[model samples]
Target: MTTQISGPRGLPLSGNLLAFRKDPLSFLTRAASEYGDVAHIRMGPSRHAYLISNPEYIKEILVAKQAHFKKAKGLQVAKLVVGEGILTNEGKDHLRQRRLMQPAFHRDRIAGYGDIMVEEAVNHIEAWKDGELLDIHHEMMRLTLAIITRTMFGANVSSNADEIGHAIEVGLQYISKKATSVLDIPLEVPTKGNRDFQQASELLDKTIYAIIEDRRNEPEGAEHTDLLAMLLAARDEEDGTGMSDKQVRDEVMTIFVAGHETTANTLSWTWYLLSQHPEVEARFHQELDEVLEGREPTVDDIPSLPYVNQIVQESMRLYPAAWMINREVVENVEIGGYHFKPGEILMMSQFVMHRDPRFYDEPDRFKPERFDGGELLKRNPQFAYFPFGGGPRICIGNNFALMESALLLATIGQRFRISRGENEPAAIPEPVVTLRPKNGMKMTIHKR
Candidate 1:
């Protein structure tokens, strides 16, 4: 015997689709507020979902009973772009791929990429002219893309960076459209949308294959320490077999796309938050100045620069890159005191959870001091501030993103202060393909 969970009433056949599509963040927030923590939501009349607002329930789905679920259908659509990489794969295959790719993201290996991260950030910041307005979102996107290309792929892709990035953006937009829409036409259909998607995807695929092929031809035992080399050279300890070209390609593609996008969004928002809150920006600069003192930031300096890290933490709390994480139930289970069917989906929104009034003081205000001594975690616990997610399937690049963001912030913040460009409206989170600024973030840089 299970209790029925009621949610917002909707029109016949459509359910809450219109409301959700119009403004997903507001809809989710309203649902949680109106129907309590475990609110039932309807995507279609037959397609059901449960928006789990409580952290305990989030912990159950992401960590405790993780084995009884799989990545949601949205990620299934992502397969169109990334193939069966760890992000979209499930069960034994996912476990194997995660284990194989784990070493490449190990802390020591991540630390080695710090120089590239700081160098890229410094180069971009130094290139910025005073009194000139810039789209900070696009700037961070390119900088992070360039850093990932050099650090992960070990290729100097500066010449073709824009082309490669445009292709990836188009492919991602196509996949996002498929995931969000009601009617997904077949990829073979020659609709204008479909043709454009295919062309963009082909360009990205060609780029990835070329990288893999070039790496394969490298001299035996050549000094290659990039992530791609690690994946290519990795062997199953028991069977002593390496991944196939397609396998390598899938993993590289997944990392390449996810690795940069999330961090770029976070940094873009960090700058925005800093621009809006001058006092916090002052503290952030103080920390950077006191620690680095006009010198470029090194990976070793990250530990000493507490305020810089806090600004990043608070910024992510406000606008997480991956705002929503969803999972399809694999077994009948009781969660948060309600019954969920095996095929039903479970969703947790970082944007909603991070801003919950119950968790933080002055939840809407930008106050980095709350995170000063790591008191935010003590007050609320792990589930409250999971910008990168949690559990066995937590983002593998969590450490990498945090370190990269902090280094980039430290390296750039030491030199200039970016304020919102005149007459530009505050960036609204669009929540597509990642939580991107709807109109992009516009700001002006001033030398410190």
Candidate 2:
């Protein structure tokens, strides 16, 4: 018999739908505050799920005790868009794909992208005008997209920045809950979101596949240094074979989605937090000024910018791009004495854990200096600081995301100052495949 873990269940089939729909973060906050580490909530007629935030419990379930879990069914919604890349596959296939993909991001390859990172940021900054009312989120998206597209696809591929940016916006806005909703129909049965998603996917595919086809026609030792070329050169030592056309396409799609949006969100929220708290902004500016003396930053500059590094650290602590980590219990198991059976959903929210008072002092305030002595993130009992997630499933794009964010922050700080517009934008958390700021993160830019 399984030990029955519990929650304050609402009556009727509606379950916690009303509560969840009204305000997800707050409703979740209330649940955790009232019910302790593990609590359940009902959403509609199916999938009675529990949200767990205790760090040790989270570590056990996601890392040390990982054998009993697989990704939640809910995340299939992303796979419909991201395809069968390392981000989606399961069991041996997942392990195999991850192994094949890891070499592409080897230390030298990532460090090589850093020069491209700084150049892209500098180009974006040159186009900006003083005192322009700009959306930092939009700007960061364009910059990161430009960098990733150039790095992954060949340089000739993404020079038309505006068009690619619009395509990405259209795609992310049309996410499919229905496809992976509690109820799903085959892709042949067209739905509104399905149609839009198909169009967006096609547009992206046409753009990517064209680039791969072009690269193939070029000589094997072509001089164009790019991620696509690196990927093309990659061979699985076991069989010594190169990636197929479709394999290349899946990876390109993954890099575009994973690389572009994550860096964009990190820089977006970093600016948002900076605008709200001036003291940290002062220190951030001081670091930027001292480090570069008004010139742009390079990958070599990253480690020296300790406070800037800490500011980015603090920013992700507050607003992780992949805000929630989810897993489904695969076998009847006991974790921290609570029972979980097959088919039950298990989630650890960075949004909730980042703000837990027990982990962070005055958790809502933005204090980059708190990380100066490395005390806040040094907690040993469990993992309280998991913005990129905890365990083996932690985002693979982490190093790429951090380097892109720091480089952009250094360059943008040299060029502009960000401030909030008249509308006090709601920093509402949208809990979908990734936690994002709901209002598009509106802000005005002042040239410095």
Candidate 3:
């Protein structure tokens, strides 16, 4: 009973590492092209990884048999960056955190946040000078940061935005570097990246703790209605108790970093996509002109702007912010005829799957029309287009993220045409923590 399951490989120890290191997407694509869909590769010393792209198989793993997998083996880095919020919890703790945080992200609560989304988008768009060369990435980041501050923590929070934003970015750098590095240092033994992470966390912690202290003084009422207030009002169903100060801080940290920067990057990619296609841009404007008469987009208007929604969907399909996620197999599992041992790591490649030719025609082409009530998008398994992953472990904030992107796209796309500036660098994919535009996406916002 000693049959060996083989994958396309090189020298046993030095397997696939060189190719993967050179260019991750290209390497994974090549491996799948040659070895057939699921391929196994080794990282550094003791890591064994598998690449999975089949939609049915992905659904089987992430959904049907979800209890069999925990988070990937290396999310310790995430805990370090954002503390043990919902993103970093598991088992009973994860379920508990999810329940406590669920009320804050509910549809009605998200609807309340929609007004903040429009107001912030309008304020930012009005201030932009036409033909000025500005990095949309920076602009989007600052705008989302401001929204998080004003809407999540109210007006008093804006003063702390800059300090908090810089810290979270630094923490992201640390987490990504640790994931990619051949060597990673323990936090106790402070290295350069570790120190940066420490300093950033310290700054953010001070600001958040101070805010929590002040919020404790506010009278509990139905009137105060930001995420923070909602969280304060939230109670555990079984125990019937509110989140402690530490739990509140952890969730707040997660919301700020996870909330702001990721949306900023997603919108940045979206505008870049819009700027590249004038025909799509024209259609987006026509939709707005016909529907709202140039008034701001609200939650009520989201369904009518089908093309606007498609445009955002297509943008995320191309430049998904979180490119890959790792899942750990907790028991003996069989996938694609490959039997995996417990503790083996499965790397689901979003960047690879989204661009795969098998599921999409000319997968590399930016075609919003493909998604407008298309056959494949509706008939195919849902996991095939999982920018937010599938099943229960799907990002708890998927609806929130989609709603924000749609409203921002509608609001800005209606009033301004983002023009492709001359002689700027094309987007370079950085495959670390999230797939970010390495060149920072420089474009001009022109008044419509």
Best by lDDT: 1
| TM-score-based ranking | 1, 3, 2
**Reference-based lDDT, residue 131, model 1:** 84
lDDT of 2 by residue, 1-448 (tens): 2655566677587678667656767877778878789988776687767888798999999788888988876556566666777776678766666667777777667888888888878877887887777767778878888888877675544466667666665566555254234455666678776676787778888888888898889875677667788777777767787778887788778788877888788898899888888888887888888889988788899989998889898888887777777788889888888888898778777778888888888888888877887876675345688877767776777787888888889888877789886577566656545666776777878877
Best by TM-score: 1
C-alpha TM-score for every candidate: 0.97, 0.93, 0.94
As for lDDT, the candidate ahead, 1 or 3, is 1
The candidate, 1 or 2, that scores higher on lDDT is 1
Candidate RMSDs in order? 1.3, 2.1, 2.1
Query: Relative to the true structure, how large is the alpha-carbon lDDT of every model?
Result: 0.87, 0.77, 0.79
Regions of model 1 farther than 4 Å from truth: none
Which stretches in model 3 have alpha-carbon errors above 4 Å? Answer: 1-14, 220-222
State candidate 2's TM-score.
0.93
**By lDDT, highest first, what's the ranking?**
1, 3, 2
- Runs of candidate 2 with Cα error greater than 4 angstroms are 156-163, 173-176, 380-382, 422-426
